[model samples]
Target chain A: MALRFALLAALYEEPLTGYDLTLKFKTRLANVWNASHQQIYKELGKLHEEGLVSVEDIPQQGKPDKRLYRINETGEAALSDWVNTAHNRPPTRDPLLVKLFAGGLLDRDKLAHELADTRQIWREQLAYYRSVEAQYFTSRAEMPAHFRFQHLALRRGILGMESNLQWLGEVEAMLADLAAGV
Target chain B: MALRFALLAALYEEPLTGYDLTLKFKTRLANVWNASHQQIYKELGKLHEEGLVSVEDIPQQGKPDKRLYRINETGEAALSDWVNTAHNRPPTRDPLLVKLFAGGLLDRDKLAHELADTRQIWREQLAYYRSVEAQYFTSRAEMPAHFRFQHLALRRGILGMESNLQWLGEVEAMLADLAAGV
Candidate 1:
């Protein structure tokens, strides 16, 4: 899975058990790549067999044995090799885009309602991004070394929602004109 | 293929041979939902099998028989059903975002170079979207009744690119700060 590389990158920071990896993947990597715990467990097994990661067995008192995975030199090299190259924007498979493109099929009233609903959704998303920024952008001294990178991802999310909200306004105006036969 | 629904929507415009569908898909749907001619042809076959579309075999003089496909009533109902509901934003799988999240993995110079390259790419893309707008937004009267819908999709592309360009600016400045040990 493409998530393997992301998991490798996470482990590069420090050794973490499967649960920690899943949590990190949720908060830290949630904006870029999202993976389920089941998927992460599966990839950890593969990384172990591939020798890209080393597992540490930590015996816990009265608890199940904890297995932590760390990225080895091989995994570090692999991640760097993958990161050195340029990456392109992915092709559009967005269902909203598809629906908008097929808008002629919908009744004008129905279409307007759809656009209005989407606008509300984007507005809520913008607020969510702001909340995220507020929580994380407390101070630079407390910032992690990778904070800039992670912050960029959050900023991207904010910018995207802002732009979408603007377009939705324009769309609503256009819908008004269409409904009025303007 | 999900592309089949897109194809069905395209056919909803009017009956067209596979060739016409490809051209329209490229020019009109390229930004929102891109599909190659080969994929379109494959979907058309599936659509026919599912009774979503009806094909007309047109006789040609000393050449291959032209096949035209049109969306049947079932297809129209399905398309409407699909379009009326809300569509969730697609999950992010961007490699650049992934890279940014793992910024400590790269040398500062290398990361700066990658960001610069992406900035250049997005700049070029902004120009491309402008060209596409000039081509389509010439005269509203010439547009189909669905023109408003199609036009909204194009505007969405322009806005997204603009937002990305702005975010890239912030990122490049941040990279410079990091490089200078700020």
Candidate 2:
């Protein structure tokens, strides 16, 4: 359901081919949502059938034509309706949390190793998000309205990763102390 | 897949009927994962057929007998193997972020209202998590090993909610200032 709206939101920014939308998900939108190229193409087909989006084909000189998608007024209204309505935060199903919940039954060293690996992954993500912030959002307050709001979503990702890293650090220290009989 | 391990982890503590496992998901396990009752029952059936778990029917008075599930040695080994393997953090799909990303195209007051509602929800959740922490984790060092690990998962939930609430506050303030033409 959210994926439908995510695709609509991406098209709201500008006219894009299905390929361009997939790239947006891989880069800018990676912080918020993820969708495979197949999912993006499938959803675009549904949006077209539902009359929420219209597609135009541009003939290429030496290649297959490109289908560009633009959100119709109905699609903009749908995005507005979804934005105005309040939704409960969806429950997250984390494999690491589940493992930690059952951590007592597992080896401490193995669990700590898992935590370390996860922390490293998050660290790289944080670095990437920071680089984006520095490059594109250095002056968020003065940015055009659309980019301002986009920055908010990216900022949330940065804070979320930071909070996760902090928790991982605390847990790693606790595991160390436990190993030392502290 | 994670759900199967979560159920197995619960049974590792002790055998439980499907009904009892569902209750755990509703309360203590809610922080870690959410599963529909039908999903839980269905997964339990699969685990039984796969020889990962053994089930026994305990007689009851006047009602249908209860089906109790116990993790087998095979189940324990499966859980151990899963725990030892590190997995990349799964991508999160958040409706709030989607709305915020497209927010510039929407009305400001409505977006702010949505933020406030989401903040209220997180505030209540934070309070609930804190209460659980106070009640169950008052003496972390003195707790049995199992409970210490459980506390770590809950603590992560608390931190994550706090981070979310902080982001919500900042966004709301920005929206307010924009409305004021500041």
Candidate 3:
């Protein structure tokens, strides 16, 4: 259901074909609400069925016509209503945390290796988010309302990755000390 | 599948009745991996069928028998194998982020209010984690290997909540400034 609103929000920005919408969702919104390409296409079909979005077929010279999706008035109203609705924070479910909780049952070296691997992954994510910040959120004060909100959302991603990285570092250090018999 | 391992980990600490296991899961493991009582009971049945866990029935004087679940050797081996397996970081999905992404469609004050509400929730969580810390993790240096791992797990929860609170504060301030025409 939230994916419905997220798709509407993406369409609210501008109309795109199913292909373009999936690309845009991956680039911008996947960090917040992860959805597959199939999900996006399926939801687009539903939104059209519900009369919340309209589709237009643009003929191609040598290929199948592309279906362009546009947000209708009903879609706009739904998106607006959803934006105002209160939302609760969802549950946290991290496999790494589970492993850490049971770490004593396994070798400390193995756990440390997992931590290192996770740290590397988060570092790469932080770098990607930083590139996004540099590309789009460089001038916050001059950004329009929509861009400002995008900036805020991006900041959340960046902060979350940074926090994970920091916690992984501290955990790694503590494991090292414990291994040293200190 | 991960929930299976989480349950095995919890039982590795001590044999617990179904009701007692559910309570312990809510108090300790829910932060890392949330599961419903029904799911836990269902998984326990499966684990027992698979010979990963053994269930013992202790008869009470005036009540029904209490079924206590203990991790079997097979369960220990399975959990150890899982702990050694390489796991990827999961994708994030925050409804608040989606709303913030489309926040320009709604009133800024509403977004701010949501941020405030989320901040309060995280603040309360941080306080709760702190209390857990004080109760169990007060002497990190003297903690055994298992306790040290538990401490590390708790630290991840604490750090995650604190980071969320900090990000919410920054986002709220940014929204205030944007509303003030700054």
TM-score of chain B of each: 0.78, 0.89, 0.91
Rank the models by DockQ, top first. 3, 2, 1
TM-score of each: 0.85, 0.92, 0.93
For residues B1-182, could you state the per-residue lDDT of candidate 1 as single tens digits? 45777787778778999999989876667667778889888889988898988999999999889899999999899888888766666666778777777777767677777777877877776787788788877775646657767778889888988999999889888877776778
Residue-wise C-alpha lDDT for candidate 2, range B1-182, written one tens digit per residue: 78899898888889998999999887778778888889999999999999999999999999889999999999999988887777777787888889889977677877777777777878888898999999989973577777888889999989999999888877877777677777
Q: Whose TM-score is higher: candidate 1's or candidate 3's? A: 3
Candidate 2 regions with alpha-carbon error over 4 angstroms = A59-64, B61-64
Query: Which regions of candidate 3 are displaced past 4 Å?
Result: A60-65, B59-65
* C-alpha positional error of residue A155 in candidate 3 after TM-score superposition, expressed in Å: 0.7
Best by lDDT: 2
For model 3, residues A19-113, the per-residue Cα lDDT tens digits are 88778777777578877789888988999999999999999999889999999999999889888988877877778878878867767777777
Cα RMSD (angstroms) for every candidate in the order listed: 3.3, 2.2, 2.1
DockQ metric for all predictions: 0.63, 0.70, 0.73
Worst 10 residues of 2 chain A by lDDT: A139-148
- lDDT over C-alpha atoms for residue B167 of model 3: 83
What TM-scores result for chain A when each predicted structure is judged separately against the true chain A?
A: 0.76, 0.90, 0.90
For candidate 3, lDDT tens digit of each residue in B33-64? 87778988899999999999999999998877
Backbone steric clashes in candidate 2, count: 0
DockQ for model 1?
0.63
